[model samples]
Target: MAHSEIHLELLLGKQVLDSTGKPVGRLEEVRAEREGDEWIVRRYLIGVPALLERLSTWTIGLAILHSLGARNLHGGYEVPWEQMDLADPQKPRLRCTLEELKTLEQSNSQ
Candidate 1:
């Protein structure tokens, strides 16, 4: 299988698809940690809360997203980095089914 190198900026707004090719949501933020000298992505976060967090700096954009029905401020869906397939850099898709990705709540984030 051919793999593509994707940068964090390219992933920010890219669409995410489930294993079944269903549209799930967009890649909002990446949860990463520094190891030695490089930052490694641990999991991918998506959904309303993730979107809100990304747009927190832009109050206007945040307000618009909230108005668009993404009112959930305390939860998000998380897919482990290993579960994601980045072969198609333009469209990142998950290897596992939607149900497999864990739904993280407020407590989990902190």
Candidate 2:
């Protein structure tokens, strides 16, 4: 599908998955790169830093800074898309479930 279509539909709250066929997190946005006519997804930013930045505490900026450092060291996030079991497959466009996302975080962190 075209990136525009993907952007309009595939992003903004789809569940993300890890390489091991396990839940990883939910996509905050679809990071992409332009090459000729295609917009290839580079990574799924996972929403944590974005969420952190909205908070009213010293933690927000720190988390954003920390995420910047971490991403630099780890390189770009390479999301595994085929395995995504979207929270609402029926709608094919729905916000990821927070409870499922928390479950994914705990399961993948180890």
Candidate 3:
């Protein structure tokens, strides 16, 4: 298999599209784990909650939002690495429908 590299900085704020070309959300964080000598990406986190978590303010941010009547506000998706197509890097796309992905809240509760 051929190996490729993409800078995290470039992907961080880029919007990701679903399989049918619908906007999902911005790429906020990447979940990875070490495999021998390299770190392999396990999932990509997208949306406002992911961003708040990345910034170390998830709890506070959510509390504030909830208090402001945004009770339905929720975290983003925890897209499995295999579900994302990074062929273009600048324009990441999902390999499946948005509904097929697990939301951050769901993943956390699992």
Query: Arrange candidates by TM-score, highest first: which order?
Result: 3, 1, 2
Candidate 3, 1-110: lDDT as tens digits: 77777889999999999999999999999999998998888899999999999999999999998899897765699999999999999999999998888999999999
* Top-down lDDT ranking: 3, 1, 2
lDDT of 1 at 5: 51
Per-residue alpha-carbon lDDT of candidate 1 for residues 1-110, written as tens digits (9 for 90 to 100): 54335688988878899999987788898888988977777888887667766767545766776899867554667888899888887889999888777776743756
lDDT over C-alpha atoms for residue 13 of model 1: 76
Clashes (N, CA, C under 3 Å) per candidate = 0, 0, 0
- TM-scores vs. true structure, each candidate: 0.74, 0.37, 0.93
Which stretches in model 3 have alpha-carbon errors above 4 Å?
none
Q: Candidate 1 at 3: error in angstroms?
A: 10
Instruction: Indicate whether candidate 2 or candidate 3 has the larger TM-score.
Output: 3
Q: Candidate 2 lDDT, tens digit per residue, 1-110?
A: 52333433545555554434455444554446889987766434455543332243325555667778854322113233433434444233223332333322342476
lDDT value for model 1: 0.78
Model 3 pairs whose backbones collide? none
Q: At residue 76, what lDDT does model 2 achieve?
A: 17
Clashing pairs for predicted structure model 2, backbone only: none
